[model samples]
Target: MLTEERYAAILKLLEEKKAVSVLELTELLNSSESTIRRDLTALHRMGKLTKVHGGATSINGVYQMTEDKTSVRHNLHVEEKNRIAQCAASLVHKNDFVFLDAGTTTERMIDYLHEQDAVYVTNGIVHARKLAEKGLEAYILSGKIKAVTEAIVGTEAVHSLQRYHFSIGFFGTNGMRAGDGFSTPDIEEARVKTEAIQRCNKRYVLADPSKYNQLYSVIFADLSQAAVITTALPDKQLRSHTTVIETDLGKEQTSS
Candidate 1:
């Protein structure tokens, strides 16, 4: 087949399946794996598709540059988020210093958290209040608040994270892709997350299955930098690169 014909065939298959592995494409097109990979790379450069390890996914599968309001996001994937949150909360021990990033899933974690002796610090305004309501030791960072996510972000927030190292940190991300890693839309918020991750001894990103295979503008931390806590991980290839805690298993299943 001609190169253009192969490209058309690849894109049509992607449109049908949303994602296609190089092996699948090679067999479908009666071409070599090397040829399919070259096509994928060219398509990726042209912004026609997202080239993931061993496969290619449609561009539509990726997230947008803008984030939804907190109220809107809070209603999505409630059950899955709760499962991830419970698993995250279980990891917190007494007297540990925890940094909780602002997001609906991370906020859900507060309900399951019973570590009253653990000191909590957050860039999330609502998280701070919720922690206080639970009578947990909590501190809210001082910084300019972003209205959409209601997270405190700025130089001061990053500076605040520098003062003390956290025992474990739980973060939220708008997107999680193998290449881009953990990402959020806003750069300042990403900065805060990046700083917090650097200062923590252990880090985890809490996300539902929908967050996978997505990419955003700003990358906060690399995929290998943090373990992911989720109800399910749709991408099997991702498991090979990082630690993933799948909470929906009868017991927590850790895969690296």
Candidate 2:
């Protein structure tokens, strides 16, 4: 096949899978590794794709792209995430400096945090608005807005977070593997999450059972960094690594 045809085929595969590795392309195209690398470089230079260390990802293409991320944000773990959020919310103190990451689970924590005397630093636009409505001090980091998750990322977001320290941080990940660590679909979101971890004294990962033992495109922070992990029912491996806070949402809610 010609180089042009091979490149088109490569992009087609990426559209279906989101990412493609050099080894996989080599096997599929029956081409040498060096040739595949050249193609990736050329495509990246043409603004057609972004070349990562081991693979290439489509840039601004029709590969399951969504303008409104709010749809996928909710309905991930409706019941479980709400319970986990409530549990995390209970841990927040009156004057603690809390950092919240962008996730469906973490977003639910906003309602429970209402009327609290705390300063919240978050990269999530939705979370920031919720915190403001709750009468708390909310600081939304400014940077490039990621369309997929509606989270602020890029250099500005990282720089803004570096100056402040949080008492605790509540974050969520796309996937969690014992070896692969905490992963996300977008690399930009991963970068912001890494910085947030450094700016916090204590960190908690909020996720559901579905995220456990899963995988994503980018690996940001490792599971070991979590001070505590709040989930519905995590697997045994995750429990061994961190303090897993399990909650049963099905149980009747007790009045305060």
Candidate 3:
């Protein structure tokens, strides 16, 4: 491929997948490894992408480097979150093993869960109590509680997740973008979220429409790792990256 064409392909991959491997790029572009490396370097120099150890990442990954208190975040997008959560909760069915990530939107999901036979494993303190009230079997991982988010995170929480794999995991992110993937500000929580996603059979991220274009410090997974359950999806690039269930418009816009 021509150098300009290779550059465009690389950026498109970063925009849709959030990250790209050098080895994969060479094969995709029908170019040499060195040529792909040079293209990535040029893009990085232009402030178009960030060069990582073995790949490139989009520059629009994170906008906020810190997480807000759960109570504060819970009130920020109340209606949008509810719609997103409801759409996500509908994915669960009886006898499913679910992983509930620690976030306000995931917490909102507690109100919409219709699966009485689903067993849950979570890292959120609030999530456990709410689960128990409904007489569902819920396990809370052991770890130091984060005061701001009221979620457990640390070595223990990360280790605990290794024991069980979920049928599907529901998550919320501090930052969202076609190029940013699912990200959060706290590295500790990011670690636990990372482990959970790895152990789960499938992943789903619950986010409000406003989350798009936002960035956080740590990316836990690529946009392709999960089907996004959100109120609206306005980014065309994002629409092509992963499956999106739009609650506001009552339409499912799916792509491969």
The C-alpha lDDT values of all candidates are: 0.85, 0.74, 0.83
Candidate 1, residues 151-181, lDDT tens digits: the string is 9999999888889899999999988887668
Looking at model 3, residue 151 earns an lDDT score of: 95
lDDT of 2 at 35: 95
Better of 2 and 3 by TM-score: 3
Q: Give each model a TM-score.
A: 0.76, 0.68, 0.75
Instruction: Give candidate 1 misplaced runs (Cα > 4 Å).
Output: 1-60, 251-256
Higher-lDDT candidate among 1 and 3? 1
TM-score of candidate 2 on Cα atoms, chains taken together? 0.68
Q: What TM-score does candidate 1 reach? A: 0.76
* Error in Å for residue 184 of model 2: 0.4
Tens digits of per-residue lDDT, candidate 3, 42-133, equal: 99889787665456656675467876688778876576788888888888998899999988999989998878889999999999999999
Q: Which ten residues in a row have the lowest lDDT in candidate 3?
A: 53-62
Q: Model 2: per-residue lDDT, tens digit, 37-101?
A: 99999987886765654567555323211222667659644665787888888889878999999
At residue 114, candidate 2 shows an lDDT of: 60
| Candidate structures ordered by lDDT, highest first | 1, 3, 2
